[model samples]
Target chain A: MSEFLRFVSHQIEDFAMQVTFNPVEGTGTVVYNLSLVRVEDLEQTISVFRATCEAGVSPSSLIRILYAGEELDGFVIPQNFCGILTLCSTTLDGLLLQRGIPSNPIGGGVIEVAENIPKRFTHLIKYEYTTIDPLQVLVSQEITSVHQVMKHGNGSILGNIRECHMEAEDDVEEVLDELTEGYFTGILDLGLPNTPCLGVAVDPQYMGLAALGGTNWMAALREEGISVTMQAMKGLCDISTMEFVSQL
Target chain B: MSEFLRFVSHQIEDFAMQVTFNPVEGTGTVVYNLSLVRVEDLEQTISVFRATCEAGVSPSSLIRILYAGEELDGFVIPQNFCGILTLCSTTLDGLLLQRGIPSNPIGGGVIEVAENIPKRFTHLIKYEYTTIDPLQVLVSQEITSVHQVMKHGNGSILGNIRECHMEAEDDVEEVLDELTEGYFTGILDLGLPNTPCLGVAVDPQYMGLAALGGTNWMAALREEGISVTMQAMKGLCDISTMEFVSQL
Candidate 1:
């Protein structure tokens, strides 16, 4: 029986494009391996992958483009680039109107061969697109801030609240310095003035950086006599580790 | 600004091994890319990956092995095989004691370079290992059986249950037929007489087959007047899509 199983070798002959949306930053990053993909159908293939995300939200203006380990020219979305796109809004309909792209509803589908790529390569492409929603945010907030912090330290610190907003800012900087070490660096994006929170977006190379950053940030906030509730999105699911200041 | 972004293009260059244990089948499958690993260090890398799982549960015996794309000879555990292993139990201490290997407690770590692979290749391997406890089984069973069925049909016909044990078996066979189509396939493992349940384990190539199969099997059981509840394990976290007969 084992001898007959010699014919069962399988290879991932398919290429995949994963588009992750950072709702806090209103940005989405498109990632695909160039070596595994055919150069000819790169444009249309990306368009379809983009269409999957567009089904959920529209992408407004291209922020940055990287191709084959180099940044490309112009803000105009190129046919061959496989990097990040900073959208104007997190909503699909809003982004479509902002970008002036006709909104055609493209529902979800499974892995399929590239439209124009050679059939001989037996190349397959799968698109995994997901957006951060209110429920996910609320669950993340409860987990990172309320549950995890209380588990680490007692709630008596809440009574020792000091009006040290400046000290809290310094703590934030220190936390950022620790998180940005090595290949797992992240950027901090401040929310609107009324929101009083910070959003940190990290690259996809590291999966647990967002969770780790969020935990450290929450701990730092607690240390400064400031109370903060944070919501973290995992790198595998979302584009960033977000730290929302719920209390201060 | 775009030119200065040269520091951003970082690729994964390390090798990894992922071992997933299927509790239902009493088996564990070790997956690693042959092209990305060294021939000599394959044994050590697999040991590390296995150790990660063995850190959780021990195995009783070796079932089978496959390398590259073919199955190797004997249960002697060759140095190059990369396929599946059928174990006796899910406990790590049990497996270590059974295999007579010293228990070197290596905690979880990230990706690292292969010992002899070419540096130019820059191939990256990622390990994702998780075991499903009884709670996962309960949650999966509740979701796949109750929620999905309630969504698909009105509960009116559930009261019209018949004593069709034979029919329920036939339905199980039909559901398995649908799930086993194409590259995706599964096996049904019956529980002990006292347990009164069945476990279905599907390969990792497909994600939602267990849920699909369980839903179909439950629906079939309902038609036969045999009320059955099932839980399915997804390939993302578990080795196979497993449907456990929760209640009958």
Candidate 2:
């Protein structure tokens, strides 16, 4: 009774993340997707969610705090607030190191908290863990660098390229129609392989079409010509709002 | 200057593992491939590698223990020993619980050392860490239950299935050729969707072709019909000898 596998990616709407495992019930479940437009971004997302509840929460797992649906008490983290959010797992990294605040190492990977956070309260959400074993669902690319988006603009140089495998359905639809027609004619055929690529291979049982066909395949790779600006980071709230949106 | 994506699966000779990340150098580089044929399997792989160097050894990381190429000295773990084998990140886990011997939770996932080990020193080598991002490299399956392989025969019920993905590259070669042709015609058409399966996708740039294509893809999925009893648990030393080989 142990055979599980789940993989979700940047579902959007502020944030979303997922990675579940079973490996014959050895257990592994990591989820991240935090939000807080302001209010000092809820004290640095409750001091990085109480340093992931002091690094180890797994008594089958539970660490309360959910609003709208109800269930919110004390709401502690540098002395409380109760607008009450959704996910909560008893944030307690020793009450954010007694109060100096600094705790990130939820034991896996990703979860950066970008240099002690705070760029308008970093865009939280990025979980990490790696043992390996994710098979299908491929095709998600969003590159950038036409000389750093013509020197800065388009979200100032972006990057996101995903690829998965296991193999065989007409060579996986001829390698997803030859990497989506060679990254949409290699990013606007700048001679042949320009630099604004965009690939897609969604359909893991139509995973909301890999985020709605990667947003209409990056708007058809920016209406075919490819001068698109940003949109690449993917999840953990686009890598915690990429250094405060690449420093504006 | 960061952007690394590595995925290596089961490169055997006892075991081999790899996972390198650098989302921007927040860092992630788990690796394992220990050894110690006997001498009481190096005191239970140094008491399960000193309970993963006392649950957490990342003060910016560096444990030290390498062999053959050099580095060994004190040896530590359950005191010390020196015939010196290989890879030894300075074994510590609180000096094997201050010499009592009990350490498990090498962080990540799937690495349970189960009670006092030793079913022939439980096949040592199983690296656990699950956050999931391992893409591309799937195909390795070994299932059982043809009524438990004819009432307890083929090593009595087995398990193994591998897969990884993040996306991009002709949609990662068409979702690894439609999950390797729907897990090889769903394990070999017993009416067009049999059961016994096998899939393998290990190829972090030919890390010795995941132990030579996982032993010729489990002997060609047991001569094409699929009855593979077991042989699918490729890295981290077959998941730390799966509960000492599923309790024999």
Candidate 3:
């Protein structure tokens, strides 16, 4: 069981990971497969975990799933599918990477939002200097005002900054355009080459890109005094397999 | 004498620092006077150092003096004026500060120039991480292609980035406009609030400003194997007392 948990925690997207829990037998199976995830196994596991998903409850407020990515449309999954779920943030990162743009993570921070518009970052920690995910540290600190932002359209939420070389400027725009067409959200801003995006400085010859963090909705839950477990950037999965919370 | 040398090296602008070298006396006096500098003494010192001023020579290529600031109009003074010289870069910093804007030094870098136009930065060192001035380090590394830029309108030269809060954006713009009218030339770019200028990012709620370093010409000199000693941001001076290199 410990080994299975470890696999789930460290899983990456190219590989498929599946976990099944049976309270009656006090037994479970953890599969680390490189091929297509067995649909039967995933469906069965989803059913078991779905019982606790609280039909009609907001994914962020629900005790089980928080988001498949930053709270864009609030995707939720069964607890059993926790670590294998794909994140919208990483998916965007992946799409950019696939096009040969080297996206370098600059930092993560609490971005202040006014009238649902990201205004500026109130606190930041660079990814290069941290031992853990900076966003995770921030979310755990409970310093965010995501709840207020949601309720009043003014507050703070989690976000991150990344940079890509200016030479790929055209390609980046294309990717962003495609993502928008595909109904993707959470991208806060894209700066011009050699410019700070969302108030963060980027290195020379690179353009900064800021996005709302995938785990921001979880922060809202944590703010409301709910004990929730999150495995951020757990691993990659076929983005198609993930369903938007609205659809669920 | 060593003490005087140290004081010269560490001089700040608020205090009037004067040094008079007399080879005949085999000694020099370094004065750190907080009061207004006596004009008679300054004129006498200036005459003595003016011997090496090389009439009609570009201040950048002359061995005696570089600039009162960056090579904007190529201002040159005598070698005797080196340490006490004012810089266009710090002058802008001061103006911003006077307007209640805290201009935070971000980094020093080698900015690429194409067709006599500032393009992008090729290298950078954050000021926060270094004990020595980052520009001095880059200049000494002998990696700049400043000479090529000067000759062929393409190469690299030194520049720096500083940021000031967005709340004072109007004040900052006012200072910039005044400087431009006054023939100040070191400023390369000023970003909109929360944007990067000249390929460097600014902190949230702040705007990044990129300027040609006062010592950029020194980089050009260094590239040509001419040994140069630079006391960057050594001190401030009355802007009126200085003459444009072209005028000289």
Q: Give the best candidate by lDDT.
A: 3
Candidate 3, superposed: residue stretches over 4 Å from native = A1-88, B1-248
| Candidate 3 global TM-score | 0.37
Instruction: Write the number of the candidate with greater DockQ, choosing between 1 and 3.
Output: 1
Candidate 2: true contacts recovered, fraction: 0.02
List TM-score per model, in order.
0.21, 0.23, 0.37
Model 3, range A39-151, lDDT digits (tens) per residue? 33444333422321222111111112232232322343433333224243544555565577866767667777888788776666555432234454455555687767766
lDDT per residue as tens, model 2, A79-184: 2222312111111111122233222212111111122220110011122222221111111222211222222322211112222222222333332343232111
Candidate 3 accuracy as lDDT: 0.50
Tens digit of lDDT per residue, candidate 3, span B5-108?
A: 12211222232123221212223321110111133344332332232122101111111233323332233344333322434354445455555676686766
Question: Ten consecutive residues with minimal summed lDDT in candidate 3 chain B?
Answer: B1-10
RMSD of 2: 22.0
Better model by DockQ: candidate 1 vs candidate 2: 1
**Candidates by lDDT, descending order:** 3, 1, 2
Model 1: per-residue Cα lDDT over B1-248, one tens digit each: 11111110110001011233333343454221111123454454344323322221111112222355453332232344343332211122122223332221111111111231101101111101101112111211211222222334221110000011222344434533543332122222212222211111112221111111212322322333332222212111122322211110
Model 1 residue runs over 4 Å out of place are A1-61, A65-90, A93-248, B1-38, B57-63, B69-81, B84-248
TM-score of model 1 vs. true structure: 0.21
Predictions' DockQ, in order: 0.03, 0.02, 0.01
Models, CA RMSD each: 24.7, 22.0, 22.1
